[model samples]
Target: MSENIIQIEHLNKSFGDVKAVSDLSIRVKEGELYAFLGVNGAGKSTTISIICGQLSKDSGKVIVSGRNIDDGMQDVTRALGVVFQNSALDMALNVRENLETRAALYGIKGEAFRKRLEELAEILDFKDILSRTVGKLSGGQRRRIDIARALLHKPRILILDEPTTGLDPQTRRLLWDVTEKLRRSEKMTVFLTTHYMEEAADADYVVILDSGKISAEGTPLELKNKYTGDFITLYGVTKQELDKIGLPMETVRDGVRIAVPNTAAATELIVRYPELFKDYEITKGKMDDVFLAVTGKKLVGGNEK
Candidate 1:
């Protein structure tokens, strides 16, 4: 078993009568890519804030990098870094200046700072934009610079809260590529929270919250295997047309979707209902399926309250 870098036990938080995080607990291992997922107002932000020492927890304990968050904040902070949703970059400063200022704040200077920047340049590929002012850079470039700044002190753990939220698909993939590579090279633990299901799919472990409580926790594959089933969607087919086959299915917007055990079952359906569907789609299962199954809600348009 890997050593846990972050441990939260029986964590509870509230605002007035509304509970933000209730009885939440998780053990995030070092060098692991952990996905912390939930819809809006699902307590994900509240929990992360408490762990980062930005907010006080109502009760329970949080330990990060072997330091209790409450009393050993200095130690915990030295081992942890966070890239929040809002851009933390100094818009007026050039990329190099931003890094230089942050390095100075962390007491890394001269040759050591130069060497550290060189190392990060290899992963973040920000060398080209070193002279470009942060506000003039694209969103993707800005985000990378933000992460590079967070890593100035070589923290053991990185907490990314919707780091790529507004980036295009290509930019998001680019950021993750750098992130994944750095995770391997630096042996750093990554704790990510995002609304993107596809991003969570690549995580080593996933924990989802709903209304201040953990709704599900497992590996992406494990969660999908347990919560979702193979299914086929017969596009351009009406439910009435499929009534002749007596297949149990739900009527979707386009047509009807029928659950199946495997390809064999899907083949059987196609064989029997050959003329029923003009077009069809077959999928084993997906993270979206697991989210819906475990939380009884959608990721994007679900009720937060």
Candidate 2:
């Protein structure tokens, strides 16, 4: 999977007066977890819409598995699977019926389709609710069924547009675990967009979009290191110990932590008062720090929310 599975170039989109995406370009390597990080109205959905042929771009190119969406989408569509933010299941239909309907649409039939559903049911573990109405299931259960439906045809790449948005923490973790497992077993490229910085931290690569354009792009650790300062956690650092160091530190769990501008500051303090520093560890900045530094706003766009 050395080749780029999805590529976009000079992409532009608009809604009357607002420029949704401007000269946006991106490349997603095959079989990697690629995250698109942004807040609401950041064009994440618009980009997904264009990719899935739900909406058209005003200008530029999109290539999926070497096939352009404009040039007969059969090859491209066959290689992609998408689960939207909102539930797509027929609320009135049972889980099995919904899967069956979707499978038929994909032309998966007879023994093969039966076998396919069985396999998905085992991995996704929704057999208990298979005969129950989708509307009766919990949000997490519904999400699992939705994911099972998307993978029934076995697309090479899976795009989750804010898939875990409203889930509880436990449900989110469960979904994330299943997603990672599926990607590993199927070698499927996972592309997702989310406002959850914690969720984005797990991606192999991340690109933050603010106001529809790429604001920053890097691996999670790299982004944190580049945009924010280093911090140190000191064990056994006390008030008297702190006085000799002459550096401000916050007390925590019989220890202290300090944010230093650079390695030099940390090393200087450590060397100056070796006895004072019982044990010290330097850690890179967090994703939230990176977000604040880059956007000059909170991760959720300034407000506490």
Candidate 3:
């Protein structure tokens, strides 16, 4: 079994009378994609801040890469690379200049810095934009630069706090592709917090927080099986035809949707009603459904609270 790179024990934090985190404990294994999911004000940011030593916890311990935060923040910081929701690059500086400035902070200049910059430029596909000012780059390009800056020192753990918020779908895919490549190539552990359900669906493990506490935790498949059901939508069929089939179904925009227990049940229905299911689509339970069923709120535009 892989060792736990990040471990929080009985963590608690508060702001005035508002409790931000309450007895939160989680284990993130090394080199795995661990997703931390929650709606707004659900203590996700608070927990991350505590782990990174940006905020002091009222009670409990936070260990990163096996080094307790209480021991020495310098050691803890060296093991982490954090990409915040907002851009951290210097707007007036070019991409290369911004990267060089950040590298100097970690004492990573000379030949080592050039090799690392070239590597990241290739991995993130930013070779063409090295001379572009940070302010002139698009949202996707800026996000990639933010990641590259954070990764210059080769930290063991990468913390992405809503890394993709306003990018187009193509940019989102490209960012994910770069992240996956980095994870595999460097054996880096990724701690991600995002409002995108589809992105979290690809995580190795998911932890859903609700109101400063954990509401659910499991793999994507496990969560879907526990909280959602498969759906079969049949087009070109009316309520009468669905009634004649004797299956519980509801009217949808383009067709009637029926909830089935599993894939076998959906297959049985299709085979049993050949004519009725001429134009139908069977979809398994999705992360969006699992999120709604567990959290009692739907995500709107990937930013819903």
Q: Which candidate is the best by TM-score?
A: 2
The worst-scoring run of ten residues by lDDT in candidate 1 lies at 296-305
TM-scores for the candidates: 0.85, 0.92, 0.91
1-305 per-residue lDDT for model 3 (tens digits): 99999999999999999999999999999989999888878888899888888999999989999899999889888889999889988999999999999999889999999999999998888999999999999998999899999899999999999888898787788878877877898889999998889888999999998778988999998998889888999899898878877768899998999998888888998888888988989887998888899998877754554
* Global lDDT scores for all candidate models: 0.86, 0.86, 0.89
lDDT tens string, model 1, 1-305?
87999999999999999999999999999999999888988888898899888899999999998888878688888888888887888899898888999899778999999999998877777888899999999888888888888888988999998788878777677778867877898889999987778888999999988889999999997887689877888888787787887768998887788887666778887887689757989877888888888888877733432
Model 1, total clashes: 0
Looking at model 3, the pairs that clash are: none
After best superposition, candidate 1 residue 150: deviation in angstroms?
1.8
Q: List model 2 lDDT by residue over 1-305, tens digit each.
A: 46899999999999999999988999999888999988788889999999988898999999998889889777788888888899898999999999999899889988989999999888778878889999999988999888898888999989998988777787678778877887788778999998788888899999988888999999998898689878888886576667655666787785788888777888887787777667778987888887778777676632323
Tell me, by lDDT, which candidate is best.
3
Which segments of model 3 are wrong by more than 4 Å? 252-254, 263-281, 302-305
Task: Report the alpha-carbon TM-score of model 2 versus the true structure.
Answer: 0.92
Cα lDDT for residue 81, model 3? 93
User: What 10-residue stretch in candidate 3 is worst by lDDT?
Assistant: 296-305
